[model samples]
Target: MDYRYKVVDLFSGAGGLSLGFLQTKKYDIKVAFENSPYMQETYKKNHTGVEVQGDVCAADYADIVRRYGKIDVVIGGPPCQGFSNANRQKNHAISQNNKLVKQYLRAILELQPKAFVMENVSMLKSEVHRFYMEKGDEEIVKRCNIPVKDTFLHLLDGAFLFDGAIDIVKDENLINQYLWPEADYFELNVIYKSAKNISKMINALDHHKKKLESLIETYTNLKGDDHIAEEARKAFSAIKAYYDGTLPADEIKSKIEPSVMIQRMLSKAQEIFQNNIIVDEYVQGSDLAAKIRSFAVYDYLKDILTAPENNYVIYSDVLCAADYGAPQKRMRFVVIGIKRDISEKIALPKGSYDADEYRTVKDAIGDLEDIKPVYTLAEDKQGIVLPKAENLSELASTLRDSPVLHNHIVTKTTDTALERFRALKPGQNFHCLDDSLKTNTYTDAKRTQNTIYQRLKYDEPSGTVVNVRKSMWIHPEHDRAISIREAARLQTFPDSFVFYGSKDKQYQQVGNAVPPIMAKAIAKKLAKILSKKRNADAKKNCTKGNGRQSHKRNSQHKHVAYPQH
Candidate 1:
């Protein structure tokens, strides 16, 4: 009990997870790695004794061991925004964000911590969330039984490049007669020819600059071409004229401007560009389809960590933060791995609180309701005084540990935002607002999530706390955004633990944090398993030295060995 286990936190954001383990009083966070400058400042300010490294990708695990001795536990929540179901971008395959998961696993592989915990979005369990197969991943992909199929790799909006089979329609009349009218087809033909001619002229003139310059200089005197808009034709001619000192520099801008007709043509060209599809090969799939390579992220993680060489027995499950007393229903995928040599048993922590017993918004932040929040990051040396309220809830009382309060900052609301905020009731969001109030807001307001502009209900736990400031989370009763401190309270951070950064960044730090209450439960469970192993090892060593222990006593506490793949 006197010994404190050494731990290293990777992708540590504002030291939330680290704080939870530190609260158990059984672990010492020796080192932490965070990439954001603001997050680094916040982490360093809170975790003063721990060394803070920059990027998790640049972390050298062997060097970490050499400097801090053996790291008993490794814990981190690698960035999972790319894996989020809400992401609508085209960079889903092999994005830079997804690689950090591998970096986290690399730490366990090199540092070989007795126990390591990885937390990420619950969507990580989905089959759609996958990483593109890289070189040397074929064997592992097949071994994991991960489903793989050929999919067109998107290059841009509605544009894709596939290295697989494809069919091309050869009937020209099918497009000209059925797809578009005669006028539309003629306009497209003119645009295509004009663009082709312009490109050919530009390339042919490259080697005959003097003649091209002379021709361009006299173009203003020539009759306008019927094939393209005058503006489009002038733009091509003005380019050489401007460089040859024939056209006034100031006039070049006006001459090169595209007319409405040309603009329409350019818009059509953009659609064509977006519709463009390219593939490396056109062969159809068969038994040869086995050559099409790709792998799901979770499959690869399980394959590598559970291998005999890695010596880990890992268990993964979706855990709700509310189950651990946080006033938010944030669900995260948690993976806990123990060194197989340390113990064959894999025990994840069971929730201590059920649905009826879960903490609510009022229990977490009801006390700070009337207090006016500041709109800036400047700290008051005297610190804002908190009002004394009687019979504060346990969660609220635990959060009011600091004598002075900080980070009670809110975003300045506009009149438009204020009107929308006032219209919402507890448990209502943007969707509840009147149609007149929703105008000119989101690009597509109807498709907006229910979480946007959410007003928390006093009796219920809040939804996942994203950047409340960005989401403009309305206060339960007040017609204003929830303060950064309020959001942090929902995540179970004590008042004394201050966040350092811009107001927006501070809100982001809070949103991205693992609820400390949940983290503490996991940490406590790990500590118990690790402590049991340590005691068992100690008893065996003593028994060997003395040669006095009976075989029956040893057999009663024998470690069970499980089969590893």
Candidate 2:
């Protein structure tokens, strides 16, 4: 039997990254961790013989070694929704999703895998993406020499809100310090209100639950208000779970903190409008600390991972999925790390295709153009017969390899959606629609992204495949939404791989996945590096006297090929 490197996948959503490593035929994915039950089902079914665990936060590295033996590689793209550019409400607090990046690092530090790969949103490379210094991070921050800065929280908005107050100031630059007083008071007031509100909610759980239930019941009997009903139902369910003591402690905190923080911020801002003069003395006191010292996430990662104790050679760069032959222009920041003892060098995977050779929408899903998708969830396996074509694109051929297709289901559309879908031409979006057609769709129709209500152009690659079902992404030539399978194909997922969940969950799984084609390129590169290291170790073992190995495996290497990108 050929030697297959053992692999462990963290945050293994829908097994897209693992699928890529599997495609290399050089990796044996022994275990995976995914928190979502739907994703866990899909991953378990697809990646047979792999142990699927839940909640990477609660994972025990020692137990894993005892059961699965030594792991060779660790690969995963932790949740990056917190780092997405679309998130407008960036704040000083590190989001729970953002904290998963540190958990990925924890896996590396504990498992001490020969090589590890991590991927996240391209925005992570920006200097603006950082972590606020917590009390625990102070010692590490100082020891790592990571640069820290004092950022005035919740003051950026005050710059505009207090523009009138600013014009009266003699020095234009003094406006920031002048407004700092108001910002500090604003933050303190919000904090106070939030804490009070949380206590009230916890104390009056029955009252709030009854209120949410009443609102949900009222909306259930109404028409043209499904979205509002859904929101209410979600809230009621959460409150019910919390009251029943079924919700996790972290979930309870997460549910309460964000909503309380945002609501209190807005309500307090209005209550304290122009009332800062009375509290100016309080703001200047030690209680109101407006300036928060923080360090960049990228700098911290570099400093900690490259430290002498970790002994890892790490490389990071932004990689485009289209550059790796996927029909989507999705860009992600990728980090590859190799044990320094295994090799003193490390490099990121180079893209094989440039702009001209990028795959198009037609190349990806053109074969499925004639097949009508089911309007609702049906059987797990559906028969798919492709139309006869003389020249099938390589991507399309790979996508059609399965004997049967699954997830070829589209969300049923309303008349308004069908109208908007028909009105859009190839490459057109919601902005091109008439004002009447845009009603009740978004909070701000003008601010709606062009990606929403988009009609795919056959000749061009699609943009990042977000939850296209929510976007209402239309077909290129047909007057319907793109099916789940089409979106998967655009993400370079072969038809043989089936998604197991509701239509919405299936779409989310596809959107959240790292394109297998891009993942395969990365896995192949790592395989070569590991294989070469193994060969070098074997050679050194022979050279040692009496054929005795001096040290444990992966501990002997002093030099190896690690070409820079």
Candidate 3:
């Protein structure tokens, strides 16, 4: 069976969301809309399967309808300039009519896909709520008869929307026309029992289990009597009984006896096991991680509420990228929406690695040859590296003249500075520089000159990459700033992904581009979901005796791994 759905990506920046969606292999990317030529080139190179359109605002909705017929899914992050925290500090006002964000919403309305994924900074949530409050209040005042103010009506409407139970306006005319009007509002009440309680119970159980294990370990280490193990088990049982509310707290405490000693042991056990607990596996940095997780939860609720209709079922599974042999600590939110009337949830395939075979940075980029630094003599007698070779250079170079050239160049480093550089590893920072080497450059300057620069350590994960031009990213070994390639590698872009633009633009794109591995993992999850949906659709068609021929495809496609050179 050909289990695939079509996807349209809007405001597609270097194809992060598009890449994630493609990972599932179940969705065919039909079109991608982006504005920047540099980003368009990068997106085109990575996503040859999709039609990359320029400037989404300039693209006609009729053209999209004409080409795709009907998009199954729409996924994109609208430009977040308004919602960015940095912008918030600059007294810049966010116009509600930002054509870019509005254009994205317009596409969603036009396409009317089965589902659409909108990602933006967490701040957008507040913006949305605020808009709803203002517009919804005005709408209620114009429409509702309740003497209560517009805010109350808006709240009532929201409550009804969430509860999926409309009160049916007593007015016959309104009920007949507006209330339950042609299923415009789908029933979406999904009861969500907090997972927190269950998770807490599990933590309590594990905590006691660990306590017993520690006692066992201590007894074994001391060659004490085996009876101590039994004692530990009994103590754990008492705690469990207390946790389950089967025994009174005072009774459990009395039964355990010597409360002080028990507390001491528990504290010791907690200390011993503190580092072992994996509190949260999800890596920070990706802007959409939390939203995706929240959406998964929301979808689950949506499914439960609409279960009676048996129209849609949302299938969810937790998948960690590390398990799939991804070299980084990448966790993803995966959701599969299936038509409940047609098929069951699809089972996720097992990941490719065991604990012992976890992928690492070495596996991702060890083979790439390191570029040696080349220095050229400056007119002032000091030396600096030519940013690019003469013949290949196509763009104006932006590398600034070195401030060190203003002073007499010191060929020989002081013993302390040499020791500091020697002590610096690939990712070491200025903090590692010895006090003697810590120069007094700031002494002659203002407060703004107090910023310190650090060296990048080659062997470790790079610090969070950004578009700033501070010299903080200098080489750990060499005094020069890190090359653009190194920054891209740090961001986990693949070696094959070539950026085309000015040096600064290249930096912005690299810093902004989603790590391909992260994108791949997200795509894989999305692909799994789309596959499930397509399978459901196929089953429905088969039952109706209107089946299409199967499209047997190759099992393997060329895959790109991360730590781009």
Per candidate, the number of residue pairs that clash is 0, 0, 10
Residue-level lDDT of model 2, residues 255-299, one tens digit each, is 333333333233322222322211121121322213456667778
Candidate 2, superposed: residue stretches over 4 Å from native: 81-93, 155-289, 379-389, 545-565
- Per-residue C-alpha lDDT of model 1 across residues 1-565, encoded as one tens digit per residue: 4689999999998988999999999999999999999999999998888999998888888888898899999999886544222342221223467778889978988998898999999988776666655555567667756666563332212122122212111222321222323343233233232332444333333544554445454444445453233444576566566566686544544454333233332333232223332223323332111122445678778888887778789999999999999999999999999999888978679998999998999999998887788877665445688867888999999999987789998888999999999899999999999999987566467888999999999999999999999898989999999999999999999999898888899999999999999999999999998988998999989988666456655665563323331
lDDT of each: 0.73, 0.73, 0.44
Native-referenced Cα lDDT, model 2: 0.73
Positional deviation of residue 11's Cα in model 1 after best superposition, in angstroms: 0.8
> Using TM-score as the measure, what is the rank order of every candidate, best first?
2, 1, 3
Q: List runs of model 1 lying over 4 Å from the truth.
A: 81-93, 139-149, 155-292, 379-382, 548-565
Span of ten consecutive residues with least summed lDDT in model 3: 184-193
After superposition on all CA atoms, how large is the RMSD of candidate 3?
25.0
Relative to the unseen true structure, what is the C-alpha lDDT of residue 558 in candidate 2, on a scale of 0 to 100?
Answer: 34
